[model samples]
Target: MKVTLRTDVLTNNNKAADFNRELFESTKTLVVNIMSSPGAGKTTLLEETVRALAKKYRIAVIEGDLATERDADRIRAMGARAVQINTHGGCHLDARMIAATLGELDLDEIDLLFIENVGNLVCPSGYDLGQHHKVAVLSVPEGNDKIPKYPQMFMRTELVLLNKIDLLPYLDFSVEEARKDLSEINPESTLFPLSARTQEGLHEWFSWIEGAYVRCVRQ
Candidate 1:
């Protein structure tokens, strides 16, 4: 019964995702779905990404959280259009939720649309938000065990932004071990160790976005 119910839910979600993908393609908007645990620097990283690329590309974000609109406000402060989706205790943002927000933002004026999923490891990974790319944010303070522990999130994502490398000296996290573990779990996935606060190793992430945007628009 559980399996049947789950399958039915995903079927509906996928249909909604297809609708969103079609709209995104039509408007030439590069949509990325970002997932991470709470305090994993998802918002801060987005703020920096916006600060660096907003002038070159028109960026917009859909902030998801259980209760507050804080993340959306921060992204808006960076001079980008942002919409907040308060899940009200939901663990993840689904394709249907994303589809509902589409009308709130005029996709024609947007170059990039980033959907920041609710801050949870398990639930967020299972749902498809109809994005061109699904990226995961893992912080140094969260420790090395996270990559292997949360295999679903890492395996489904094409890129992993290993944030908080600036704290390498203060913490006991191992970058090489994370690389090894991720390679074992998802060999094709790319891992970038960056600190959103210090702006270290962020250029690679931004470049990835730039490349993806070009590819998306040219398609």
Candidate 2:
């Protein structure tokens, strides 16, 4: 079924933008929306990233899942303020959902806010949650063809994380192919290939994120 986005939805989305701008202006937090397919290591990356940067920067996470507090619990365990938004069968998180959760977070103490969107490629790409950047993750096991198949997801993302590179030797995936495809769709996006599980190639990821955080805070 084709879903036609109505004008009201667009208007509401604009309101969401305004809310996000106001919240960021008041709190001075850089919001990042992490998006990807299920089991693409969104939460795992968040855990690693939080562990690396939390001491230097105040970071919080709002995890969106279909129906569980599991991801949120994991984030909270790392000593960061975490909130879960259960979509209740919805494939994506809308702006109002995020707006509702704003009061629950202590924005004053946060320098970065990472919203892990529901595990889907299509729906989440269409919604604007007032984020400063959209970081998209593509696991190696998911194959190199995913870039062309889901061009919108890649095209809109500011950073593309080619995760699960540790499995490349076992799979038929080609890093070059993935890079080529991504270049075709989004030539300017910074791509990071790493393993969230083994921590391989994580330093570059950490550096990129830290640099981005510093830049955002400075602005």
The number of the candidate with the highest TM-score is 1
Q: Kindly report which residue stretches of model 2 are placed more than 4 angstroms away from their true locations once superposed.
A: 1-9
Candidate 1: tens digits of C-alpha lDDT, residues 40-113: 99999999999999989999999999998899999989999999999998999999999998899999999999
For model 1, give the RMSD to the true fold.
2.3
Name the regions of candidate 1 deviating beyond 4 angstroms: 1-8
Model 1: worst 10 consecutive residues (lDDT sum): 1-10
* Clashes within 3 Å, all models in order: 0, 0
What is candidate 2's TM-score against the reference? 0.94
Model 1 TM-score, all chains together = 0.96
Residue-level lDDT of model 2, residues 1-219, one tens digit each, is 998866665788769877986787678788899999999999999999898888888989999999989999999988889999999999998888999999998888899899999999999998889888898999999998888999999999988898999899899998888888898999998788899899998899888877877777777
C-alpha lDDT (0 to 100) for residue 95 of candidate 2: 87
Worst 10 residues of 2 by lDDT: 5-14
Structural similarity to truth (TM-score) of each candidate? 0.96, 0.94
Candidate 2's displacement at residue 97, Å, is 0.7
